[model samples]
Target: MTAGRKRDAVLRLLRAEPLEIVARELSVTAADLSAWREAFLEAGAASLKARERDDRDEKIDRLQSKLGEVLMDNELLQAKVDRLEAGGGGPFWVAEVEAMSPAVSISTRRPYGLARVCRVWGVARSGVYRRRRPADAPAMPRRRPGPQGPMPDAALVEAIRGVLLASPFHGEGYRKVWARLRHAGLRSSKERVRRLMRENGLSAPVRTGRPTGPRNHDGTIIPESIDTMWGTDMTAAFATEHGQVAVFVAVDHCSAECVGLHAALRGTRHEALEPVRQGVAERFGAVEKDAATGLSIRHDHGSQYMSHDFQKEIAWLGASSSPAFVRAPEGNGCAERFIRTLKENLLWVRTFRTVEELRLALLEFKRTYNEHWLIERHGHRSPAQFRRDQMDTMPLAA
Candidate 1:
């Protein structure tokens, strides 16, 4: 019922009308009429309480106002007493007296006013005000201001754009872009590059709403030297005719280099070992027993990775099999990060007609990534370049 009708029914109830009569007249049930009447009575009681609260608040506000006035008067009296006790001396210089005033001293317990200090010093308050302002103060020009500290110029912005365009991988963030610019001999700070890219709407799209949990892994995935550790992982992509195919990759932990890449029709244990075989053949020459005795392979706890044959194969190649923590993908984080990059640059952006096509694409992507995709930790050098640079620094064995 409308509020007006409810009010009318409530009024009839207040007049002691029969409940059934009111309910029939309002076209409502007798129970509803009773509920409405109860609600009206409760609301009336609440309104009366609210008026009482308002009156109490008004009285409290008046008391607080009177208290503030009394405090102000007390402060004024105290300030006058302090000035009187400071000792009224003969006329003195306004600046000298102003300097000695407790009001000007930041450490004073109770500060006095400038006028009171001038009165105590027996100097004209007008003269103290006159000494405070310089005749040429308003005429002085403010310091000329411009951009500071190697601001992003037009050429730098163009260089940043060129870096993004020339990148083999997509979704390169500002920090990587800045590092690339520095590698190209265009000197600029990370912050300036970030600001310019943000202003120009050249920022990478970010994923959101990821739930956070306690970190289960803390050790670094990137080792101190190359060939010490290699992280391997598998990802799937759709082939137009063959459905989904698996792509496996192996990355050197220290150099961030894609040492091996393989795509197969099946994601079995045998397929997982393809990249390892390739990496072994390329890095350690022929794959024989104890050929890569000092090297280790890091992989997650997938069936393919934990299979007996897979473990046996790595042992035969003389490489140790290091399984990541059961639930922690970060233990195999280097491989996982490379897989994401692969998706962003290849799998997600293109479709393959067959497993063979995907294999060729994976090989091409591996070469391009090793030659063009810059690693920030490696002084913005490509993985291939970084590996070559490290090889130069290695001491020759006798």
Candidate 2:
């Protein structure tokens, strides 16, 4: 394009046969024409001048446009980097500027220039330059230096380490280890003890138990009075190799405590009745029938619960069996909730084929559920703690 423009200008100049006339023809000043004329005279040909001017003008125009765009982009990027260095989500150049500021002071018109602040912080210029530091770098705690030695009671330390390794979810940070040591009647803090474990490279493979259960559906009711209602159901278990197993669970609606959990080979009417038999046997063994003051057992109308055999068992125990509305599991809300918790926490963690295997796992988890696991919604106390507190105040053997 520049070549074409120059050719047009030269043609006009040549046609005019004079500098002033050529300038007039080409719509340029006389000085512009004179500059072109001098080049034509020195180079000994008007064609040479035309070629140089065309190439030079093309380069200049291209560079000028690019420079303008680059300037705008640079300004935008500078603003963003400035914000990030000023502590937004920009780039690293701003931090580099901040880091470099202390070595040689530079004036920034901003309220707080980088150099002044760096001086106040007393950070070394060389340290930042030597390595790029991340945002999270400064927050890391340095390890304490100590004598390289074995624990005073190496045997006890080994014992604590074994327990932590054995339990699937005995997770406490270093601090918790310290607390656990004291709880286990050991004198050492885990912080100091961890040093030994670290030296030995002792660490457990952590596993997330299972996904949390779905939230309670709409219009679900929770019983408020003890013995007024109960929620019972069978949860299918997951295992390592074998497919699935079943656990019959009975929970007091108000208390939400596991009244009974019976692992069964098959999820049938008999399995569902086991918990009822156990509950009744515990309360009034050898009695053919007993009066229930205010009792209702809410459950889904699964084939097992709907069977005549299961209904007769509940009748024999003198407790009314209330099946939820067909296609409405939410009608028996409490049992569904317990089932969800059981599945996530225990059942989903493993695949059990044999009922005995499921039983062993459930027994351990049940004890932990009763004794160790904290229920924050229940005043951060375990189920056992809550029960003991309630039982302590009750008029027992009345």
Candidate 3:
């Protein structure tokens, strides 16, 4: 209800009308009418004391108005002081002064005087005049040339191109090409070769994407000497009638030589062991137990690798089973890298009619890879050549 109506009801209640009747007329409860009556009486009594409060409130309002005026004056004074500090006329701070000085001096009509600008900016007038001097007033002294390296000749460029074209591997990077040039009795720095290659539009394929994180395993798979460790992995290729055939391969870690390869219809635990058996028979010259002692076989956590039969077979052959880190392919990077190469050169590039045909093809690919595939880390020598070189360096057993 409005204040006037509420006050009228309270007055009715004070005039001795029945509280329920007045409350029913106003559509409010009797309790609400009683509370309003009490408040009205209190307000009537407070009004008698309101004269002094009114005077005090007027005084407080005057004081507040004065405070607002004083604050506004202070703000105006602060604005003037800020303008003075910022150097009133044109922009006169360091950056602003530098920007405006040139244009102000060069103005066609009523050009601003350098002396006036310098005084406003609180800088020496001579400095303003010196900066405003014409660019053609005196030419800047030419810079002296520094020592230069030997320039690459056209012969070097041709040699680099020849090396790239002659490379058996596709997408050879500049570093490998540089190494090849060095091997061919041509002397040039790697940076020079890289520049030449870039200028000539000779570049390795660009691999786009975020690179992987730090490798989980250090390059301990390829040891200093041969036969310390062997990495084994399996890859699959489609055969026309056989659907898919799994080809298992074993490689010497140090020499990168494919020791053995076998293709079969199934990738069972028994089939996974075939490459290891072949490697053992060839490397040790026998299939007896404990023949290939002190050798470590590295493989992933595939069911075939983890099976009891495969584990027992390797153990009986005197080789320890070394499982790679779970979900970390870098732990078996050597085997994985070899698999990629095998797929690129043989498996993905060729189709087989049957498992037997795939087997024969895998055997032929193994021989070709071992004899011809060049390992750059081994001075671009084939795996077979690297193995023979290492064997020659070893002292004959007594």
lDDT per model vs. reference: 0.83, 0.63, 0.79
Q: TM-score for all predictions? A: 0.63, 0.44, 0.58
| Candidate 3 lDDT by residue in tens digits, 1-398 | 89999999988987899999988888999999889999999988998876655887989999976765455444434544687787785434454445544442221223333443454546676655666687579777543244334543567778887987776555667877877777777767777778778877887766685677767766566788888789998888899998987889899989999888999888999999999899899999888889999999999999999999999999999999999988888778778878888886778777889988888888888888887677789987889999999888888732
Candidates ranked by TM-score, best first? 1, 3, 2
Candidate 1: global Cα-lDDT? Answer: 0.83
lDDT of 3: 0.79
Cα error of candidate 3 at position 341, Å: 1.6
Clashes of 3: 0
Alpha carbon lDDT of residue 309, candidate 3?
100
Instruction: Enumerate residue pairs that collide in model 2.
Output: 238-350, 238-351, 239-350, 239-351, 239-352, 240-351
TM-score of predicted structure 3:
0.58
Q: Write the per-residue lDDT of candidate 1 for residues 1-398, one digit (tens) a residue.
A: 69998998999999999999888877899999999999999999998886445887999999976765455445545555676589843456675557656443232334556765666445688887878788677766433245655643666778888988887789999989988777777777787788778877899888894776888877677787799999999998899999988889999998888989999888999999999988899999987888888899999999999999999989988899998988888888889989999999999999899999999999999999889887788877888998888888787531
Question: How would you encode candidate 2's per-residue C-alpha lDDT over 1-398 as one tens digit per residue?
Answer: 26467556665666767777767767788886666656655666655556546887989999976765455444444554676687765333445556444442122222333443434334454555545566556676545476533446467568668656654443433444544556567766556767655665554334675554564445545564455677788877654445565678877665666666888657889889776665556534532565442467788878899899988767766889877777666677667766766766677666665667878877777666657644444564555776677666667634
Clashes of each: 0, 6, 0
Say which candidate scores most in TM-score.
1
Compare the candidates by lDDT and give the number of the best one. 1
